[model samples]
Target: MLSAGNPYVLPSVLVAAGAYLAATLLTDASLLVRIGLLAVLAGVVPIVLNRLLGGGSADEWRDDPIEDPGDGGADADESREA
Candidate 1:
């Protein structure tokens, strides 16, 4: 039921729950390992969600030529005056 823009929210919530469960249930593992696993889940979950949502690769915005001001080459005027 979640929208595409909010796809990562569910995964993030799940990761938090999983981390809490691991801490409570797995007493033998070191704290560092538990933290590392949580970190990996946090990083990977968003990427997977984004891919599933059909997000495009990041792109730089470029202005269209039609949107530019038609200044009529002011530098040419300056050179003529000089």
Candidate 2:
């Protein structure tokens, strides 16, 4: 559930700045080289940072335990059969 208010905001901003720096520093390179370098940084930085920071999945809500509706006998009988 990525949002504007996510905690990753600061790290993402830092990564963007670092990527810009790397891109500028390598300005003498060919267009293809620059594009490739930027692509790699764009792909790797967020993943690495997220892994290091233990950022939960974008779809983490799906992994949450769903509350039973407590429909009474139906759930109870099903559990008893198990």
Model 2 stretches astray by more than 4 angstroms: 1-26, 63-82
Q: Write the per-residue lDDT of candidate 1 for residues 1-82, one digit (tens) a residue.
A: 2333545756676876788577769777787877777766666666677668854333312233545446767766888998
User: By lDDT, who's the top model here?
Assistant: 1
Residue pairs with backbone overlap in model 1: none
Best candidate, TM-score = 2
**What are the lDDT figures for the candidates, one per model?**
0.63, 0.62
Shift in Å, residue 55, candidate 1? 5.7
Q: lDDT value for candidate 1? A: 0.63
Error at 50, model 1, angstroms: 1.2
What's the count of clashing pairs in each model shown? 0, 0
